[model samples]
Target: MIGNDVIDLALARKESNWKRKGYLDKIFTADEQAMIVRAENPTLMVWSLWSRKEAVYKIHNRTAHFRGFIPLKIACQADGKVLCGGQFYFTDTIVTAESIATVAVLEERQLSQICYLQDREEVVKKEGFPYRKTNSKPVSISHHGRFEQIVTLTD
Candidate 1:
């Protein structure tokens, strides 16, 4: 399965104060927090890790049919893998001046393609996954602020 997330840096800067007391403790593991503290750009590091966690959460949600918002529980390691509920997920992060994007897939799934979409509805029409057919290859789409990204897993 594939999952993805995007964060708009401009909007995030205007809206979030990740440095506030206890904010890091609420969402990041101790190791992650240390990485942030050591980062050259803490804001970008925070959002990059956040995007990765959110992406992994999406895949966990679909596969386990569960839902929750425990960001700290999703441990994102420095090596670009996420650990949650005894499962390990592979993840990738992309950081641009304008945004941060992350993609996650099950450890066993091979990613076939990655693309950007201006309109997600086009996927339904183009891929013929009207109800988002689960039997079909898993694809994840995420949009934030001005950007939209997708990750697809192949057979």
Candidate 2:
């Protein structure tokens, strides 16, 4: 399975205050918070980390049928890995000044098999989750402010 997320920087800045009291503590583990503190751009780091967890969580949710916002239970390691419910997911993230996009897969090697696309017309929702209409491969779609990203795992 594969999952993806996108975050628009401008919209995030306007919508979220990561520095608000207890916010970081609520969203990040201690190690992740330290990473944020030491980051050159703390805000970007926060969102990058958030996107990674979210991307992986999407895959986890699909497999586990889990529902809820349990951010702390999902951990983001520095090496593009996410740990949740004792399972590991690998992530590839693209960060720009305007947005951050992340794609995650169950196997590390599948990272290269992720296809990013812009054609939304081929996407359809099945049971509230997006999938490719042609092949029915699980498709992930995320949009934030000015950015929208679509991804699917290729055979």
Candidate 3:
């Protein structure tokens, strides 16, 4: 399975205050928080890790068929990987000035393709995996603000 997430940096900057007391503790593990604190750009690092965790969570939810919002329970590494509920995931992150996107696939699965779309309206209109012709794999898609990202997994 594959999962993906995207965050608009401008929107996040205007809306989120990561410096708020207890915020990091609520969503990040001690090791993750340490990485954020030591990062040259803490905001980007925080969102990068957050996107990874969220992507992994989506895959977990799809496979386990349950929903939960315990962010602190998801452990993320600076190198863009995640562990949650004893399952490890391979995560890849892309950070640009305007957005951050992350994709996660089960560690045991092989990722076949990745698709990124900037046109939110078009993505919303299409509304499903649009790259199946090129790669017949289960895909997960996510969008936030101006960014959209997809991750595909193959047998």
The number of the candidate with the highest lDDT is 2
lDDT of each: 0.80, 0.92, 0.77
lDDT of 1 by residue, 98-128 (tens): 9999988776344334444444454553333
Worst 10 residues of 2 by lDDT: 111-120
lDDT per residue for candidate 3 within 1-155, as digits (tens), equals: 78889999999888899999989889999999999889998888999999888889988887777687879888997665688888888887878889988888886334444555443333321233333444455567787887667555443
Per-candidate total of colliding backbone pairs: 0, 0, 0
lDDT of 3 at 121: 36
| Per-model TM against the reference | 0.86, 0.96, 0.82
Candidate with more favorable, higher TM-score: 2 or 3: 2
By TM-score, highest first, what's the ranking?
2, 1, 3
* 1-155: candidate 2 lDDT, tens digit per residue: 99889999999999999999999989999999999999999999999999999998899899999989989999999999999989999999999879999999999999989888778998999998989988999998888899888999888
Clashing pairs in 1: none
* Model 2 clash number: 0
